[model samples]
Target chain A: MGRIYKKPVSMTKIAMRYCPGCGHSIAHRLIAEVIDELDIRERAVGIAPVGCSVFLDEYMDCDMIQVPHGRGCASATGMKRVRPDLIVFSYQGDGDLAAIGTAETIHAATRSENFTVIFINNAIYGMTGGQQAPTTMPGQKTTTNPYGREVKVHGYPIKVCEMLSALDGPIYLERVAVNNVPNVLKAKRAIKKAFQIQLDGLGFTLVEILSPCPTGWGVIPKKACEYVDEKMSKYYPLGVYKDLTKKK
Target chain B: MKNMEKYKMGEKVLMKGNEALAEGAVRAGCRFFAGYPITPQNEIPEYLSWRIFEVGGTFIQSESEIAAINMIFGVAACGVRGMTSSSGCGISLKQEGISYIASAELPFFYANIIRGGPGLGNIAPAQSDYFQATRGGGHGDYRVIVLAPNSVTEMGNFPKLAYDLADKYRNPCMVLADGLLGQMMEPMEFNFDWVDPDKLPPKDYIVTGCKGRPRRIINTLHMIPSILEKHNWHLYEKYQRIEENEVRFEGCNLEDAEIVIVAYGTSARISTEAVIKGRKKGIKVGLFRPITLWPFPKKAINELADRVKKLLVVEMNMGQMVEDVEIAVSGKSAIHFLGRPGGSLPTGDEVLDKVEEILSKPASPERERGK
Candidate 1:
């Protein structure tokens, strides 16, 4: 009998601290699998953000650094610039990436910094107790937006993929979701390609994963997945917004 | 190596203060620099923009001061000597990032060529950032090693000292200067030998890769209150060690002097001349310039307080370091302040005038301790 799927060698045996049914587990597993398949685990450097994914250093069995809130890309830029040989990526949440770190994200892309960013957009601030995020859906009710997000009051969701696609510095930009098995597979592919682009010395590749937050969304595990597929996917369309590898 | 070919060992070259420090950093094996432009310190990044590439080093004109400091934080994590620079308003923006660097105990160096400021004050030189620089300039209970250099030669040389102390303690070190020291042109030789970064020893704490060892995680987050408290204690111990072992200052004419002028950085330079002039006039004055501002030369000042009748603190601010001097003296010596805040630099004549006026007064009996 052939060997079936097993836990990735790139991941440590420590138990994850992510909330049950949170998409961080899936994204972590996918990233670990990608790192293992690419055989760059030894030379991989991960920058963990301050959101719920702050414990990314615990799960990923690679040399990692935890940066201040929302400065992941800036730190990643420093790491990758100094040690261009190492594979560097910043694991950031929606608030970490788009809200407080908006300047870092935009400037890193504009400079075409040679690193990968795994952006998990759960539409709400997870570690901070379900507060509104930059990607929070309009009419969505969060801890800060109990009456539901009004476009006039709370502002529209920041379409990161679309916004970054307008910049010429990025070599690849893709949006994927981990709501179902097929979508999970696509998300993994996009992540692997983003890393591969970085390995090729391509500049500033990012994959925005529309991850689910069952606890934050006040929904069961299944309903969170259903909400991502039914409602979240409509607001954040899934596809490649920019791919330099693809010619017109 | 290629970029530094022009600079000979022990050769005194005429250069601008900011540019000399930039070159000195490259000589000190600083292979990475990320800085944003601000007045008085812009020349550092501007010079390194071309100079760093000559030696195959990385230089980044960061999008903001916050980004620059965070980038250096990353480089330091990689076990490389990285640095950043800015003036007052910009350093204000960098406080949060500096806090993170200190909390993580990352070894990095930075410079603050301070301009006048309570807000975006002015581009002129000022020592107003004394409180901000010595008091951690950021959140949390942390202290960065602060070196106040008065001369352009010290500006060129202090980067090596900052790097040495930073690496020794795994703490951030700051070379605190002002616009006058940063922009003035002077001839000075670098104090340290040329350091090829590749020749430096590898750091165990650095996060290069887990090639043959367990993975390394450099982090500052301690979620549990007790654990965080323990981390703070650990940091406090390191700070105590630094205070014990690394306090540096310069004392001139202290023997038999009746009064002492306490100052650092630009004010120290001015007071040096004032002390010399006051001596020619038989005023019996001395200068005590603190080289390390945080682990401030408290012992020397306290002892001097026992001998001197008064301690006159000259600063380009509204009497900030005077409080520290008072704390060090503990009411043993009467204290007087001469301030020229908001970028108006005090001349030697002005400081000398203040020194004579304080000396002319009868010794205050209230602050006098029983001999």
Candidate 2:
């Protein structure tokens, strides 16, 4: 068979450790392509969160630091403060960023630390055996909440991008999905723009990507994308919440 | 007159302890001050903000203690001297950042004006943070250099000393003072020469990295257990070196003294007055003041163990320094404690009466005869 296309230079040659058909690899490749296109690979520092992607340090060619669970924002804050000349970004899973690291995320945004945050919302905790997360939809069943997530008991799913967009410190805030090829392309553009905002000295930019976790969501790889479109999109509603560069 | 003038360091200035500390930080070339206002130590950040701006420095009133500490972390990572000041509860909030700074081996100064605590206990002066400051407040096996300044003059000089010691050792150093010293006004001399931050030796370990050269990663991650253990061992060795070279103490008539008063900070100030009162009554009592609480002056007090019949440790808290005194005395002499908690400062008369009671005791002939 003839080769279909060349591998993106930004993507690592090594085999990925993520589950088969997982959206992480796609998201990772897209971010890598953006970094390659922008020519920021050398000066870019990636902060790996304490989740399934904790070993992101090994995959990326650039320098990376693994932050404690719920402390990716704090570590990125420290790094950006130390090296304001460099382009810094953090990649965090929903469980890590939305739950344990909620305080750090809010405070970092409030302080408007000049860094980009690539937040992945998979609705469920992937690494910890499909546990319920802060972004888990109402009435969603998980290992922790087997019966179902009752809003009265567990609270409604948090809309992080919408919440953070209200803060003046954040220069850009957008939510996108990886459920389809077209949406995946849009998410890549948002991610690149988020990093570009920091490069321009604009403060606190975040791009929330609605990703699919096939194994955690208890569905086949293709069906996982369908579930994200049918259920997750209804709740998350992907779009730009705040774009300071845009005019009315 | 010209020859005598050549021997002098600088002129004396009567300044409040907090103001003196701010001036000392500036003199030490500290250009970044980020802190939130708290009781007893408000003057520290207040003075530094205006003065630092006047000296072409940066001063920020961060939204919270967490922001203030992280700001310091950022500036320190740039290889510049940065500082933050807070009282008890505020210090508790800064512990996580302190741990990271310690593990990163970044040199910065933190002034913790201790107040009564276990939780928002009181804004009043207390040495309750002794265990937290000297024994590592955060979650880690790290030790920070703790300088306990007794008087306002020492408060002025301690910041400069703290900056030097932090850079020399590449570790966090704290100026641990209480509310009494933080609030008190006293005559201080800024005689020490300042070290310009811009002129200091370049730090190769800073996170700035080799711009066009090798890619350097600054992190505290050690996947290998043995490497982490080795790093911890090296830190312990540094602590040992600091203990030997940095331990400071002031001995007042310790030779042939019957009773020795062991104290530090404001408690030491009250102990000095008590020693004078005891001497006026013809009691052979002396004072042993610990200037540096950590890398504590154990050796000096141990040497005085044989000379003094009794050692009395007076403190604001209940018997915090008494343990150190006992460890120093090692059964050589009777170690006693006189402390007041909850913002109470023991007066000279109270300490003097205790000294008389200890001296007037009959029974042991040698102890009585020595008095």
Candidate 3:
């Protein structure tokens, strides 16, 4: 008999509670694989925010703290201060991170808090059944905007990675997508690098992954991935937003 | 009798209220101090920065009040004694962090040296933060143990007491003072035993979690509304326990008194002198000084109500603590309120006149005659 492939050690045997074909599971698996590869499972502390990834604490086989909605950055800041030895990371969705928690995230980065932030930007609020998010592209239709998002009324989408990269405190900032296998591989690398930056005691490092929300986008799972490639990628261009490693 | 160590309690010294509070925190085993400098309370952080460095402790000047408070939250989450001091406007910025600390059940200390106003209140001392401190300032339903210190000595001692109380109850505690107490220079003595954070029992419930034991979790999440209701009830029950166990008050010449004056913090100091003046003028008056404002000394006042005919509640704010006194007296005595707001401190003469006026009223003429 041939050897069987095993699931990532960082992933628990507990079944994920995410909806079928949701990209959150993929992102979770990628992060878990990185954790297992880096051998940081025992020392890793995950901060899970409210939204679809609220149960990221359960899925990831590591110690976790569930922060209040829009407070993941503050909670993670606290955790990082206490346990500077441990690798702390905050997993936040677009609405939770970019909208309500904007100040916390921006300031934490500006203060150069040594932690990793895994920002999953799906462009819409998924957990609350498809509401408009800060990163939702113009003309994108959400439950709250049945007439499509109006630029005059709602303002343009926030480019968090680009905006944060301009700040001096962040040691690493990158935006990656997880719609395809190639992008998935790149995202894993970016996630691993973000953790490694924290391990090096470097300042804040965030990897904003443009993920797909099949259920929230009102499209088939395959079409959701295609939609991210054709539509979302144009609005939020991929590639490294900032990297301090190559500076000196 | 000759060979003994004298108990050094209540010895006066010349020290700023903020400096005394910093000294008190250090003596109380506060190893972590993170704060941003704000008016009327900047001396606290400045003193801690110098003193904490001398004692081989962490002293971080955070980016802002928001960051400073969050840092304290982090240190407290690690089960270390941590504290932060700020004035009115800065404290407003810390509400979110305070709410998180409460939910996480982290015991920490905070010092609020109040200043004037509804906006960027003046740097001058005021008791405007009464509502924010006593009541829940944040969104959620929560309570913090608030200790109002009147003198520099009390300011120095309350930090230690606040730390002990916070640890014992597993809740955040506040040492509430105003500009007078924050900036004044007075004598203070440290008598409380030092707490060695290293020798303390291990905090298994801390976020550090069980390294070699079962996975431990500290959280305030209750998905079910029923569970949340139960949790809130449990918190209230703990508050009730605190109210029963930790009510502190000082009764000065309450026996055979014609009138009782209720006051706290700096106001209490003035009220004491006023009571003395009233006594010299043949008015039999006493002062009730509340040390712990939250777990108020209700039973003590209730007991004193039978002895006194009239009650006057004197405060720096516009009749805030008067409400508490009324609740305690329960209509047994006529409670007269005297207050000076907007950075103004009430003088001894002002309080004396208020007490005399309440005593000489036609309703209490018998009490006035006895005086």
Candidate 4:
């Protein structure tokens, strides 16, 4: 009998440096698997952001560039515009995507740049020792907000998929979680569909994976998965925000 | 010369400095341009908006100066000639990405049509960004080749030089001009034929795809302290070579000069006029203009300081490059400064008068400061 499971050829043999229970490794695997399944590993280029995923080049066995904080989409836009035949995607974390890179994120979508964005929204700043993030839930405790996030002072969490869905430029937008086996499979499918849309020469496509950061969240790996399903999923619902391919 | 015929575009055409420089970049194989609109340099993006499409290149009026510079960083990483342009505060915004590109060792090109500034200063011709441009202009210990173009013709021709040097060194190169040069109209001719970027030799480091080879990664993060230190040392050595081999300057009547005026960009143009007027009045004034700001023409200035009695460093700022001149002179000659900061331009008469006053004075020990 054939092997039941195997690593994707697009993934490097190097062990990821992510903390235990950090969803970055899984998210990276999903992207690598998607690239392999599409058979576009030879022409795929990834742009890594400045947060925890800055070392993304070590995990993805494809042409990749690590861009400055929040400038991944801008760099990816440059790569795509110059070489339209090549597949390009930018992998960014919550702070790297929603906070500092808000303008880059919004404008790239506004222009409908032909590229893919694999946004990992773990709702906290992982690399910087659990600092308050742009998507931090109200009352969520963090290193910066030692007394818990106050809505009046800290403001509301940004809903990236919902905010971006309002724009007409992007051809696809989806938010999926990686809490359970089924949800992980669904995330892989969404990631693959985003890449397929890019392959078909569609406009901007983004997949926001509600990842887990157990260490940042001050929880165990098992508890973090439960927290994602019970709390994070309720706030950031798991569904397609927009899909140009679907008819009204 | 036989080579001249290859690049000769026949007759000179009248063109604004910003538009001509934009055309020059396209002719020099810059296929990607991303810039934001700012005073004194807006024509650069405006021209390239339609012009880039004509050559089947990419033009993006990027969301911000940060995005624009990063876009060039992206294209340059792909081993393609790409550029961006902005002025003053806009350039301040681009420094973050510039540092990253320099650290990654990507060949990049850009231009700065400097306007008055500290914060949203008026859009007038100024060279206040001298220290910012020459001192790496960013957080890291990196250097960018800064070419100061004084005239419209030089503005039109310098992009080719900037791109060639950037590619040769795999570093950032910038054409540093001021609002005067960017807006002024002059008859200029192209120095080279339109280059086809496709014909350029393929670079092995570009990120096109892995295909049959091992994948390539372009990055600047060296988490390990020792590894990062080694990388910094590598950049330092490259800069050392650049300083040794790439120092460039243009001097006139230095053989028998009593006073030499050290200047660049708009100040250089004004000082050139002062030199001519001083010569007519038998003042024996010569002009020394630096073309490359970083890797500044220091050794030559040090040598020239020995022969001249006094060196007058003129600028459109509150004496920025004058500091470099002093370092190079190192007490060899009496130094004087004439500056007009904040949207002000020094007239030829004012500079000539300053030169005459310095010559008349009895070599004071302190060497007069800024006027």
Candidate 2 TM-score to native: 0.88
- Which parts of model 4 are misplaced by more than 4 Å? B1-10
TM-score of chain A of each: 0.98, 0.95, 0.97, 0.98
Each candidate's TM vs. the true structure? 0.98, 0.88, 0.91, 0.98
Worst 10 residues of 2 chain B by lDDT: B362-371
Question: What are the clashing pairs of model 2?
Answer: none
**Candidate 3 clashing pairs?**
B12-B187, B13-B186, B13-B187, B150-B265
Go through the candidates in order and give each one's DockQ.
Answer: 0.89, 0.28, 0.36, 0.87
True contacts kept of 2: 0.13
Docking class of 2: acceptable
lDDT string for model 4 (A101-188, tens) is 9999999998999899999998899998999999999888999998888999999999999999999899999999888899999999
Best by DockQ: 1
- Kindly indicate the candidate among 3 and 4 with the higher lDDT: 4
The CAPRI classification for model 4 reads as high
lDDT of 2 at A68: 59
Isolated chain B TM-score per model: 0.97, 0.93, 0.92, 0.97
DockQ-based CAPRI category assigned to the predicted complex of candidate 3: acceptable
At residue B179, candidate 1 shows an lDDT of: 97
Q: What is the C-alpha lDDT of each candidate?
A: 0.91, 0.81, 0.82, 0.91
Span of ten consecutive residues with least summed lDDT in model 1 chain B: B362-371
Q: Is the docking of candidate 1 incorrect, acceptable, medium or high quality?
A: high
Could you give me the TM-score of model 4 versus the true structure?
A: 0.98
